[model samples]
Target: MKKVRIFLVLAITSLIAFTSCNQSKPVKTIENLKAGIIGETTASKKYEAFAQKAKEEGHDAIAMLFSAASNAEAVHAANHTKVLESLGEKMDDFTPEFEVKTTAENLQAAIEGESYEVATMYPQFLADAKAEKVQKAEQSFTWALDTEKKHNDFYSNALSALNAESESGLPTGYAVCPVCGNTYDMANVDDKCAFCMTDKSKFINFD
Candidate 1:
């Protein structure tokens, strides 16, 4: 009878352990969501500053691009904030740190920042969100991650064109998806945002 009781106790303990391991949702935390929100807020403001500088420098096309990108970042920031709020996470007011440089230098900085998001930051955040089983956060992070990759390519190409001293004509139109903040040159437009399927007609046009 003693041995049987001991065996039953072990079985119950194992069952409890297994059940705990199979939790439907990840452990609740909003650190990553907060960080993402802060990052997006900073990027939005910095890109707007960069847009103004680009316009002052007579890079109208680049200025428009930056402006559109800034709007997109704002959208991402808003999304992150909503998610954080939904999770009952309150973000304290904080100022973001960034430097505004000449258009060329700013482009380089943008490239580096976007590259970091694509290569390091977003990937880790996405993994964490996944591990935590926060599907909304995961989706948001994925959108930002994919969007950052596009921004990196855009900045890199623009920098190369600037360095080449070639006449890189400005696009006829620039559009940003209101839903996802995806920017498009619109020189040769896509029917819709590849990431979010937002209709092209619904995009915010930047002059």
Candidate 2:
């Protein structure tokens, strides 16, 4: 009788542990929802700054497209902010620094930033939406992906035009990786520091 009672106790304890492991956390809380909204808003502001700079530099076409994108981003951010506010959570301000030396540099930075966001950040956002069962979040991410793709194409065309007009008829001051012997094309190259993978500053920049 003693042995049987001990066995029963162990069985109950094991069952409880298994049940706890199988249970999933609650879905679609205000905290996570607010985070998603804030991220999108931050991205919108970054693009807005980039668009303004491009206009200052006379890249009118690129500037116009980016300006349109900024509007779209603002709409997305505001929608999310409204939802979060209804839940009694205040959205944080989002402002990002813009750093591009020239018109070409701005285009390159915009393309690289967009590509990274689409490939890396958007996927994670989609996964979170799926986990939370938030259909709106998924839709928002889809739209962002499409917009980034268009931005990529626009930058590609602009770079080609710039390359064609240079006096030497070639890209200026661009260096090649001695190890990879790859010509630096700012629009497409990985931002990884090729040598040590520490900082992009380590990589040689070709004008």
Candidate 3:
């Protein structure tokens, strides 16, 4: 009887340890998701301010690009929030603080922000989600990471055009996938989003 009790106690202890190990991963993933939410939310608000600045400066085409990218960032924040909720975590309310500057300076700022996400923030979040086996979080991070890279390149090209005073403006239009925030130059849009496979027809177009 004593041996039986000992065996049962050992089994229960092992099960508890296994459950704890599993629980720790989800906690870590939830924290990563929350951080992603903050990053994306800040991007959304900053881009909106940047769009207004561009409009005020008469860079209408660049303003439209910023507007589309702002919407895409909001979509990314929503996706991250959804993942957090799925993990049984509540998302904290966030209000982003940003400075508004000249169109050229704002463009530079946007480029820097996107570069950080591509090179540092999202990469670390992606690794965390992957290690935790949180597929939804991983997907959200991947989508944001890829879109930020594109945003960086777009901002770079726009800055170049602005500096050169080129009559040939940036792309005629921008389209954003509502599902995954994958942005495309309207001139070269695919039938489906390269990242999320969302139908191009469903993309939110900024013209």
**What C-alpha lDDT values do all the predictions have?**
0.82, 0.58, 0.89
Cα lDDT tens digits, model 1, 1-207, are 999999999999999999998755444337877888889999999999999998898877778778888898898888888878877667889998899989999999999889888999889888888878788888788888877887787777777767776536556457888888888877755798887898799988987
Q: Count the backbone clashes (under 3 Å) in each candidate.
A: 1, 4, 0
- Model 2 lDDT tens row, 84-149: 565456766655545546767766776787688668876776687777766655655655555556
> What ranking emerges by lDDT with the best candidate at the front?
3, 1, 2
Better of 1 and 2 by lDDT: 1
Residue 24, model 3, lDDT: 55
lDDT of 1 at 178: 83
Can you give the lDDT of residue 4 in candidate 2?
100
User: Model 1 lDDT vs. the true structure?
Assistant: 0.82
Candidates 2 and 3 compared by TM-score, better number:
3
TM-score of 2: 0.55
- Tens-place lDDT digits, model 3, residues 137-167: 8999999999999999999999999999872
Model 3 local distance difference test score: 0.89
**Candidates 1 and 3: which is better by lDDT?**
3
The alpha-carbon lDDT assigned to residue 123 of candidate 3 equals: 87
